[model samples]
Target: MAKGYIEFDYEFCKGCELCIQACPVNTLVLTTKMNKKGYRLVEDAEGKCTGCASCALVCPDAVITVYRQKKAS
Candidate 1:
């Protein structure tokens, strides 16, 4: 089956958690893992993303890039 994913620019992320709230699939979450600046970052909690880009849309820093995998027929 086709699946979706997101690539996050952790360095640019401000840990605002907006993306986590915007995600429709509830796949995104904030982790205890810190970035280079010691700020917690959002991560893909579930691998079931649908590439809706809702998380990307709400990100103030534009740190998310989404990709979709095509399923074989």
Candidate 2:
């Protein structure tokens, strides 16, 4: 299986939770940390992301970026 991870653009996230809801692996969680805009940030709770891009697709702010590693042969 391909390994995956996500990066968040903290400034752009609005704490909408849409991405959290869309994540199939349940990797994302709302954090106590806040950005300059004062919106709560979301983070990868577990390192189990599949790079499916579901969270990115649902993010209205386009804050999430998913990266996948190619499977070894």
Candidate 3:
């Protein structure tokens, strides 16, 4: 089975951990590496999300976008 979710734009991210904490299902994690602006980027933790948009709503940078997979028949 494959997992689905949003992908973050690391370059635009400000290392703000709001997305990581905002996730309802504990799906997101922050990376140690910094972006062009020396900010940490958020990464998905492989199949933990419930496709909720909490993080996207709270993100000031608007770098986060959630993509949900269709249910199998």
Q: In TM-score terms, which candidate is top?
A: 2
> Would you give me the overall lDDT of model 2?
0.89
Provide backbone clash counts, one per model.
0, 0, 1
Candidate 1 residue-pair clash tally? 0
Over 4 Å off, model 2: none
Q: How good is model 1 by TM-score?
A: 0.87
**TM-score for all predictions?**
0.87, 0.92, 0.80
Error of 1 at 13 (Å): 0.5
Q: Highest lDDT, which number?
A: 2
Residue pairs with backbone atoms closer than 3 Å in model 1 (clashes): none
Residue 31 error for model 2, in Å?
0.7
Q: How accurate is candidate 1 locally (lDDT)?
A: 0.87
lDDT of each: 0.87, 0.89, 0.78
lDDT of 1 by residue, 1-52 (tens): 4578899998998899988888877888789998898889888987879888
Query: What pairs collide in candidate 3?
Result: 15-40
Q: Residue 65: error of model 3 in Å?
A: 1.5
Give RMSD to native, each candidate. 1.8, 1.0, 2.5
